[model samples]
Target: MQFKSKKVIYQVFTRLFGNTNTTNTPWGTLEENGVGKFSDFSDKALEEIKGLGVTHIWYTGVPHHALVTDYSKYGISADDPDVVKGRAGSPYAVKDYYNVNPDLANDPGKRLEEFQELIARTHRAGLKLLIDIVPNHVARNYEGASTPEGKRPFGADDDVTLVYKRDNDFYYIPDQAFQVPDIPEEFKPLGGDAHPLSDGYFDENPAKWTGNGSRLAKPNFNDWYETVKINYGVRPDGSYDFDTLPQGIDEEDHNVHYQFWQDKDVPGSWEKFRDIAWYWQEMGVDGFRFDMAEMVPVEFWSYLNSHIKAKNPDALLLAEVYNPSLYRDYIKKGKMDYLYDKVELYDSIKHIMQGHGWTDHIPVVQKGLMDIEHHMLHFLENHDEQRIASPDFAGDAEKGKPAMVVSATISTSPTMVYFGQEVGEPGAERAGFGSPTRTSIFDYIGVPQHQRWVNNKKFDGGQLSEKEMALRDFYQRLLNFTVKSEALMGAYEEIHFYNKEHTPGYDHRLLSYVRWSEREKLVVISNFDAERSYDCDLKIPGHIVQNWALEDGTYSVRDALYGEENVLEIKEGVGHIPVKLEPLQSYIYAVGD
Candidate 1:
């Protein structure tokens, strides 16, 4: 149960587990086509992932699923519509709870062995493994939903119920709980038909939003996903309505799944999920990177956090919650070890490289990192969104890309680099689906494929870009600093702004913060204004501000304050040392020895 340091996480996409191929293929039958078992993965691939300065690899999409051979499975195909869409099935569709897709391991037992070996190798190389687990729902037609061979129900045994009554059943129970209407929460619902026979790719429409991959295939309960809907309110009339309100925080709190197992302590469900986590852990995984943890009940996660820690305290738990407003609740309730640092990421990248105008979104990001001392999961581009290279690469690969990488890694949180990210992999065309296949992420997986197809000249088509490599080297330096220096590792004591009034000139557009440890202190200054520059000096504790050193490894005295070893000057006026910042340029200065 011991976990790896939370400083690094590598995003491992399921189907592309080892292959560099970006194709969206189902995990059910990869071996039938020749990929062999997960243990059979080429050593070369494992080493490739290890090359990045990552301490843990977040393996996305590793659970079991019923592979579909039908072309019309997901409701879109070459014939139906969305011709631009790829044929890969979403791995989010869970088919079994006790097993993994056969394709992942030649023999499930052998797969575990291989995974164990991988973990050992990772640990030897100083890395950890984290597998993905989905708790919200299961695949449509799971087990009995299809045939005798596949008939697995939602819960193991007595957890499922058949609601046939309307008046008495909660699905049809009339009360104040069922108040909201389907028309719209605020605005009217818009009507539209499917896109016309326009060769899907022609229009180049912006990507579609994504959802968790579980499927109900019917209107049973409030339908978060269109493909599968569960019936939360069951009436005597043999009908059920998911959209109806149940007794809880909101209409969506019906908890149809929980109701199925209500008689028992539903909160304890974490044991089942935790057991699965342990199963993966036993398989030699370093830990787990939870998916949409906020969507699950907080109390349930608390149990999980405690249980996982009991087994392995070092196990890193990264919660994928995007908004900052809810981070405190999740962190407090679930005891989730880490959450995504959407704030620092957006503030540093979009606002800094793009423009201070991007700061419009800074408030949200800032609040999420409110406890700026403890770290949160941070990244520039992950599997969930577009590549920073896409919008900000700004035509010139050299300057645009390198600056972005530097900005992302230097933030306080441990950095997460999604697959193809270091090499400037473009995000999926579809942004928010449970399974992000059909998007560009799936198209450029293999090393050979990426080199030939990736348009960026900076990347040789592998997971490394020239700028990315340089930035990666910088990360290795930072990692060495983070792992070796206890003071620089997690959270800062305080962050202050050195206003222009105190100095010759200062710009509010420049986002700067000071991170310090009793033994060491470093100031991070980022000029968010892509068009303008800022000349400023951070006001620090007099003693710590006495001297400075540049990246070249040379030391100098701050004569303006005091001479070398004379102790820093803080007796009177503001100690201002001029820092000429360029547009979008960022600096990390080590203050004290």
Candidate 2:
């Protein structure tokens, strides 16, 4: 397979990206706290995001979910507060797979149309669109109000008395009534606000399994009580009820995988999800980001993803899978385009940034996964992770500089940046559902630092401070460079080992590497220490110099990041370069000009 330059993804929470409200009262309603609409992403806003060098925009929370708001006037049912997580609700608890959230549309009846228009706008801005596809679960009170004709809602034709059925969409515990979670005395639905559904009661004769696979009649507070798990041909006794993928089929392409499933006998749930993905593809969505993808059976993914790719070969299929052991299986067999590098790379980088680990482990990790390196998507912040500038995290926005640089240029993988990460958005708001650290994915909240960058929808950094502006500028420069660099897509060789062995003061606090192609070559280095600067002699090995076939002489190298130039001398198949780096600084030097 041919390699491509790094793709940059900008993830924005759909409801909070354009919200200019500053009133962050816990459990506040949409009217009180204000909500961002699809119209909020004006041409100016999208152009600004494009200018930041984003190729794809993952518009999170676009699906209609179970929220505590009343949309009954629009023929949509109201969600009970006792069953909902927060004022805005969890995006993963999808209610209708075919319809978008009405809260995002200026007119509730035109929610789907508004989303379609947003897709057109995104394409016009020279970017692709990605939406969430939560196939592992759905809202507890799942109802598809806007489902197309001839399409039935989930569980509509199911027999609720059985504990498990291959055709049933959900697993039910017979004869048991659903019980609302017991909350602390201080905590109340909607913060003690009075509502008819806030009496700690819900009506369900046969309690279904909770979203996290809890079979309890009454799940605990920590359980995912707001959602219910979907049945996907896996029996409760750990036996497969569906046809398995043929052995040695993991190496085949999606087209072959699609053909393999054409005559297979699968359960109804598999076909239902395939139809759902097809529905979204017809709606002009460029791709999908599957939540908790590991929870679903890999065979089901093979069935669904292969069909999706057959329709649009360029469709991006990303998933949130954490297990390192299953990474290759998911990518090769499940047909996933990319999986989160959370357990290995992200965890290692976080430890290094927090002063708990050393950068020496990074080279070992990169070498270990060289065969599947491009399949691992690198990121510093997402909705689930803590902000880089949060108090519980590094507590300083500048600490992300070296980390982001390394993440973007380390391999041929795609890179992601959460919406407010550029402007140093410290997610410190005390939202209703969870404590402070990560930006609340469940509440009606406003991001302070990102709001400054929004500048009341002007899409300018008019309200940002000098430090914040500088941080965003740095991100823009790094991202734009990564997307256009040819050497980053070619080959990687870790030079840290050679430098540490040859240089007197080279140690674990600094990391260095080289990336090269037939047309271009780059020398990259980063300083992880926040308090110290390093001046060292960086060396390129004789084998690498011979591979490049460079004549021994003096050469000038220019830092692509900061426009600083230095002289490098090549003697007898070896290249020696001098580097001076400040605290948390990085250099990407274009060699042999």
Candidate 3:
């Protein structure tokens, strides 16, 4: 695999991205809160995103999911408010695999067509499209009303009488009638507003398992009660009913894995998901972001991902597998292109940003995952994580600057930034289903900071404050530089160790590293301290200097990020560069000839 330009994924919650309304009434209706439609992502909007240096747009919640709104007029059944999480449903609780959210279409009946148009628009803007693929579970009332011809909905032929069956799409607690969860006093399905299906009653006989694998007849409100787990041939006794991958087969590529499953007999769920992935690929989607990938079996991924890769060899397959032990297994065997670096890299960076961690630990992590660093996608904010400006996270959005600098330029892996992260969206809305820290994935809420940047659909920062504009400018500079920098796509060497020993005033709160290609060389440094600027002598090791074949003279080094120029004195194969960085400052210096 040759080195490619660094990929920057801009994850946009499709419904919320274009919503301009500020009416944030808790448990508000779609009309009251206002939902962004597929038409909202106009050509100008996509061009602006592309200008921000994004290579792919992960259009979250694009698939048809359960919602509280009544779409019965469009031949879609009304979802019971009792089982739904919020006015807008959880994107992971996909109700239809072959269709898109009707709420996102200007014409309800043309939702799929609208999404297809969005895909074409994204491609025209020179950006790839990524949508969610929740394989672990589906909506409680899973229905494929718009499934393609010759394809049957999941569990259409399953034997519901049996608690566990290889062909069954869902697990069941036989003879037990499903019961609605007990609601808390302060919370109501629709803010105490009366509705036809708000009576806390659902019609699921022989209660199926909850999305979180809860077998209780009435799942706790905190559980994933709005959805049900998909059965993947794993029995209740923890044994697989289907064939497992051969030993040591994880070393093989997707082509070999695709061939391995050629004559194999997989479970019904496996084939169903494989077909679903292929269907989307045929629809012009470039790739998929698999949600909660760890919950599903790795073998299923091997089958699905390999099949998708066989169809489109360049399809980006990103997965959300938190378990560090299973990271390599999923990448090598499951053929995943990237996995979330949440546990090791993101957590470490978050801790450092919170003033409780050491910057020294970052190099250790990078070195530890050196072999698979390219496969680990880094991000400071996503849908699930609290916003950088949120009180629950680093209260100051400026704290994300140095952290993002390290994340984006640390390695050859792809970097992701959530929508409005650049403009410092605090995500402090009360939005019905969840609390303040996270932007509600389950509610129809307005993102204030993002709306300011949206500026009534102008796609410009016309309404943003000076500070917000500066922050966005910082992000644009960093991301654009990252994508076009040859050094970032080349080799990495941690200079933090040498700096900690030889460079005076350099401490654990500061970090330095070097990235170089045959043509370009860069020395990156960051100051994580919230207070106190630092002026130190950043050192380049003698071995590296000799390797780079620098002559014994003073060379001018220019900051690639901020355009600050400095001189580097090289004598006897040791390069000493004078560096001055303010609090929470990052400098990416391009070493010149």
Candidate 4:
């Protein structure tokens, strides 16, 4: 079903991976065995997720990685020296569409039954589960009976002459010193085939230097993701060969004889994918997360969205696309119902809370609210990147950073809390992408280990430093407030800008705004800065609010029409009737009661 309002998506990455009991490292062995399996966790874990009042539950990596013979193809070693190293099963690497790794599902044949049971449990407690699906490209170097002797079959290709000059070996360039593998006669490379290091891959940018840049010489799609690129066809051979339509092909008709790796001509590719999706559906999965969504042609989604609507429409679809143009396009095309709003996230947390930008950041937050209401997926962290707790940019992991969890929950979109973020996990980092707190989902860090960490209360009062508690409490209260307030569910607009400009007394620390519905009105004022306060003036609309009550923190309210309207003073570290906000505080007031 389409998400009706904001949701708290409990990221299960850490729960599945970090727990020693439930987790197995390096894809092969489990420390605790059956970590995320329904039988493994105390009902409390999933129950806590439901307690957050989230509408959707997104399980990031539920799919099994296909077992490949070649280690290089999978970007991993099959027989890693350390058994724990096998825990790095990249969830994106889908081996079989239907099979749920035994670790995830106690039983494969009865996987759907267990999943349906879990969904029923969740629904009974009021929630939905969303899974991940990677359709952009299949796992490279994956060998199946369907896979030919040399390379994995991408899709059906008829026109090989355009790519190669020889009979069966035409896909290889002259002096390439590579032999085309024993690809079935019916399935040959479409065009631009090579020794996997062909120049000019996946570039369609109008600006020559702009975009993700050119593909690398190696054809390892998993290595840097830049190793091989899919062609979207905007320019010429160097840019986008799609622009140079062959003589026999109809350029306007993207469906004609083109160099598309997949069946670009077929309108029913989405339908075919639906059948594959149905396999997962049969596995009792309620939804899927689409990977590299922007790369897929618009026509594919046009069919996919409609197909999903007809099938198990209750299934969730989350798209992993970042750019604004691509975001707008996917949402408009009905291709994706939700899009990640990282800009809103980065700006709100960095520029606003870190006190680096404007007090006018509240206006930016207002825009973010508007964006979320229309189409935005809110998230504080995920597996692909570094942990928010990393001591890279902000200082004092224990006491002095910005309030990320508070702002993330309070922000206006459906929220996703990555696996270890709640417990203040500091995960490993990649060279360029930044530090991601998560490790492999199934291996390395399993449930049993997490159980020890949890018992130790490594993130609790004594073990965790003051700053950690602040971050934790911020999230706890934010979640509690989200559940307690109706304003969080209402459509919002900026009633006032907390500050006019970024000046000496601009108060970049405090952000104030309002959200209103047919039944009630709400004023949300937050202090993003650590220890700064300002005499902020909010011009309230006439006759809209006669009386207001603070939903969470204490705060004072005054009016120009009625000077010293309401004197709210902070008492006992909290204001009673008067509105008073503390460090990293958020006040939600109900008006006209």
Candidate 5:
């Protein structure tokens, strides 16, 4: 039962998911783009997401961030355009950690109640809730107006005059005043639109360090200037102001880490983030996706995550760590349940999909992380990545089919499905801040392809074309089986190497693997070729057949992806199943005795 409950995270950008607006004006006001509300995620919407076999829904951008929108009526302060990334702000620049985003609420004044209702609705749909918890930084103006009684905002207790201190929440420039980054002549805050707040000046005496750790009074335009770095007791000289973990602690479990920190005194910032996480847990949030986890110290994670596990041992602590070398440190010492597998598996698959690399490199990547495979979460698309259908990417959504199958079933790790990924949403809009290949989290813009599936709040794919519907069905079938199949969480062996050496018609464009458990067995193969189709007598070695205890008999084999019936004939000892793979096609054959 341990591996049977495989996790699939369906990440929905809260402000964009239910927004049906078709007018995608660059740097358009929230009214023009029509931001999706917390209420937009109706019960039917949650059920539709749950229907995709998602165990958790990552409601991204839930926390209140520094947006250019005017919410003064709700007692929320307006953010200067010079500081914000886009009309709608970057989710990582959290303005207030204690409050939910007003843009995602039907009534800005009752935003908290609406989010709580969303948490209830999400749980009622038999799915857990996940939200972003950015501990490394906060908006330049961190106003905790909604912080409950007795809870102070960040920097409230900091000695702002000091450059660094054990109790200080932020690193300061001492006497220097903060100046806005020199605006490049080519770029404007609201796509060159005029706003009273876009005057290219921010008034701040004794400027704090930038979010990316830029210590200058005026951070560069390319830096995360909208946000300021949180001081986790890490000094200017790169020394820890807090107690370090015991030696060899990275090899121990979270419980051991938790016990070690029980008698120790942690930094003030550590306590602040722990309290924020506890506050969300009280509101029924089951987990957090820590933003830019690598930027923060691994020791802080060990402290906070261990405390989190103490309260809810099953809590999912997923982190956005991209460095391969830091992967084990973040997972083991940091006590994170999962880390992004972007650098290894994801990059390799994307290269193959873009017709650049051979599938032979996939096994090499997978083999390197066999010990910690379960902690490496797999995903093809996320908010930061370009859409599969974008011209800059593969220029075809169909290419993701085989890649998605291989990503999901390759190991005993969790899988993430970005919203609009299933329906082939090409992020072609000219959003304000960044380039267009990836969906913009900066400006207020509607997701055109995803809106088709939204279909005027119906939450049904009523407006989807046949091809889009077929693509979604492919995801539906594949993900539904993945979440229920114990074999996906079992032992894995790359059979493509075996097939390439032994079987004819098998080439480098094809990848084959086998996964099995006590109850279920799966033979998975995918074709990465964009123009070539493959027809190969897929073979499992004699040792694997003997391991499965297959006798001289014909076994029932069917494609779990398309329900294509086939037979696995065991002659002598080797098991053979004939497979036909079109360009970018994949098959997960369930072998039954």
Candidate 6:
């Protein structure tokens, strides 16, 4: 449970990572906008990713999902367009827990074997593997293909007559037939292509509840109508049908949580996911990235995550849980390793990037989450958010430098960077299923900026513009230093407040902090201002001066990331260093004798 090195996670949308197709036609078929296969992650490609100082690679959308492609030759039925999101489908709408997306394999029938090969390749490259697991819902037409021996696929044992049976895998609407959501004017199934199944109908008897918990037979167009919610022993009237965790269990760790559930029986849904996790662990997958983890009960997590850790103590368990109030429960009792820090840090930093918030707000957030900060992972861009260089975001990749530095260095939590974020992809592609601000998760399209680095599967930066190469170099230096810097893994104390009051010319647009261990001391500073640089004297506090056991003398200091050498002068018991911070600049200086 003790974190040693700072871990960086590189998230690559699996379907888009190596696609070289430039035909970005909206609503184009897979033939027009080709998909990246599992085979595409060559040893060279993985080496390029590992060179970013990443410890893990989260292959987004790896599971078998409902899509509009025909795969009858591979024993998979064609999915109805009415319920599929795009030519490629929403990765979250998983249709089979036992298999991977056929679209990612060179041979559809050997899809699982190909993915196993990928897992081995990733580990051989000295990087770990992390894949998505959507526990809250499944594709509307989940197949559960390739079920293991002596096990039933989900809903195979369900009683369709009951609305909420304790052991039923999915909820049912007793007498009503399933109805597809009303199609919005802005979208059409297959982009109005004339397919037989695109007749504006999806057949289902006694429709299950929509993924968003919508009870309507025909959900609204905006609802998560393509997915069906899983029933985890919680009934229609909101009563728990299974055993609950002990009252004080939230205050304990996973070991205790696991012990508590040892003798007790859990809902069937819990068993389903537990088996799935073990299946991947057996395949050597290092961890998982759970989707909408908060929607499912915490007891289930305690049941599953502890089971995972018991098998492999080093397995990483990252999740998407937005409720700050429940953070402790998930981390402590539920045994989760990390959760998304979007609401607090990402939201505040985003405002600063867009010219609204001040750097002063950053410390307040840190102060509040100090107890659980390391358990909260930091990210600048992911599948769910706008790219840092998008017009709707900061509008320039240069503007993200300071924000990225702050997010990465402010905590010991894992740092995540989307595949294209380092090179400033603007997410401007007009992919068929979504808008401009966010990358399309539902369509088959190439990522122009990231594709440049792919360089026709050479996995080289040959096609990058000069500016892009520079940006990527900045990332390389910052990220590479983080994993090796002992101070980053130790203690942290912010000097932003002290400097605001004592240092002349210091203002809310600039912030400073110090990180130290017995062997290393670092001065980290960032300028949040977009248009103005600052010339100021940054002071190291007397307490920190004492912590470092310094005297009235000079110490050689140099920026570890960009090599700005300077001298740190300690007069009496206080330390002062003159610094020049360019607009949106950041510095991480190593203090030495």
Question: Over the stretch 1-593, how does candidate 5's per-residue lDDT look in tens digits?
Answer: 56556799999999999999999888789888888989998999999999988999999999999998999988888899889998899999998999999999889999999999999999999999899999989999898877889878899988888999988899999989999998776568888788888898888789999999999999999999999999998989998878888889999988898899888888888888989999999889999999999999999999899988888998998999988999988998899999999999999999999999899999999999999999999999999999999998899999999899999999999999999999999999997888888999998899987999999999899999999999999999989999889898789999889999999999999999999998889999999998998888999999999999999779999898878999899989988998888888888999977
Model 3 clashing-pair count: 0
lDDT of 5: 0.91
Q: Residue 394 error for model 4, in Å?
A: 3.5
RMSD (CA, angstroms), candidate 1: 10.4
Give model 2's TM-score versus the native structure.
Answer: 0.98
Order of models, best lDDT first: 3, 5, 2, 6, 4, 1
Worst 10 residues of 5 by lDDT: 183-192
State in Å the error of residue 189, model 5: 1.4
Backbone collisions counted per model = 36, 0, 0, 41, 0, 0
Tell me the lDDT of model 3 at 561: 83
**lDDT scores in order:** 0.45, 0.91, 0.92, 0.45, 0.91, 0.91
Off by over 4 Å in 4: 1-5, 14-18, 21-38, 66-87, 106-121, 143-217, 220-269, 365-372, 393-412, 428-443, 446-477, 495-506, 533-580
Off-target runs (Cα >4 Å) in candidate 6 are: 1-3
The predicted structure with the larger lDDT, 3 or 4, is: 3
Worst 10 contiguous positions by lDDT, candidate 1: 168-177
- The digit string of per-residue lDDT tens for model 4 on 1-593 reads 22234566776652253244432323333432434564442355556556544556776655545321223442332321111112334566554444444345556446546655666676665667777776654433221222224432322331332332111210212222221123332222212123232232322121111013222223222232211122233222333222222343322222222223243343223434656666566655667778778766654554565566555655567787777666655665544667776665554565453447654654665464465444577665676644555554343232222344334434456667665465566654221111234444423344332344344323223445555455555555556556545556665555444223422333546555556555545555566666654444433433233323333333444321112335443333323233344565455555432
Instruction: Report the number of the highest-lDDT candidate.
Output: 3
Tens digit of lDDT per residue, candidate 6, span 1-593? Answer: 34488999999999999899999999988899989999999999999899988989999999899998889988998899999987799999998899999999999999999999999899999999899999999999998988888877888899989888989988898899888877875588878889989987888888889998988878888999999999999888888888888788878767777788889888888999989999999988999999999998887898999889888989999999999999988898788999999999999999999998988899999889999988999998999999999999999999999998899898888899999998989999999988887888999998998999899999888899999999999999999989888888889999999999999999988879998888889999999888998999999999999989999899999998889899899998999999999898988989989
Candidate 1 lDDT (Cα, 0 to 1): 0.45
Writing each residue's lDDT as its tens digit, candidate 3 over 1-593 gives 34579999999999999999999998788988999999989999999999998999999999999998888889998888788777898898889999999989999988888889999999999999999999999999999887789888987888888899998999998899899988786556766678898898899988999988899989998889889999999998879998889998898888999999999999889998989999999999999999999999899999999999999999999999999999999999899999999999999999999999999999999998999999999999999999999987899999999999999999999999999999999999988877888898888989999999899999898999999999999999999999999889999999999999998899999999999998889999999999979999999999889888898999989998879999888988899998889999999999886
Q: What CA RMSD would you report for each candidate?
A: 10.4, 1.3, 1.3, 10.7, 1.1, 1.3
